[model samples]
Target: LAKTTQPISMDSYEGQEVNITCSHNNIATNDYITWYQQFPSQGPRFIIQGYKTKVTNEVASLFIPADRKSSTLSLPRVSLSDTAVYYCLVGVGTGANNLFFGTGTRLTVIP
Candidate 1:
């Protein structure tokens, strides 16, 4: 699995936009870049995913480079409830399987 690094903590006020970028240089070809958002005392929820280029969903947007190495997650108009940990994973065993949690970025939404 490819390793990712994100900010340990970020301070953002309510109704502000927050963008968390993840670095995964050694990502494999078969690996899909998946982003997960985890609230306090809760499991991480799937935010978005992309193999290459950009992919936008109802929750977040995933931007992947042509090299398929690193990616970025953009959250629009975040609020206090949006404060949570963001995790980036390469991929699971197969299509739609289990998730292996790793060290993720902890986002602090300041009121």
Candidate 2:
């Protein structure tokens, strides 16, 4: 299990592109980077995952370098509704027991 470090908070205005980077210096070869977004009183939802290079979905894009020790989650043209806590998780693909919770990056979207 690799520990993730992210900013304590971030602020962005509506219609802005936000990129949140996470650092995992102790990542393992079998580890993958996974990102999640959570709203108030709700569980975290999977945003994206990647091993290397770039992976994109309807909502966000994930970028991983060849070293695989760090990742960036990119949200395009965010709105006020996009404000939430974002988490970066680094670990092998296992069951729930392998998951570790850490302080997430609080993203505030302003109008």
**lDDT of all predictions:** 0.81, 0.89
User: What's model 2's overall lDDT?
Assistant: 0.89
For this target, which candidate reaches the highest TM-score against the unseen true structure? 2
Candidate 2 residue-wise lDDT, 2-80, digit = tens? 8888998999999999999999988888888899999999999998988899999999999998888789999999999
Q: Write the per-residue lDDT of candidate 1 for residues 34-86, one digit (tens) a residue.
A: 89988878887989888899999988888888987778888988888898999
Candidate 1 lDDT for residue 76: 86
TM-score, one value per model: 0.87, 0.93
List where candidate 2 sits over 4 angstroms from the true fold: 94-98
User: After TM-score superposition, what is the CA distance of residue 85 in candidate 1 from its true location, in Å?
Assistant: 0.7
Q: Which residue pairs clash in candidate 2?
A: none
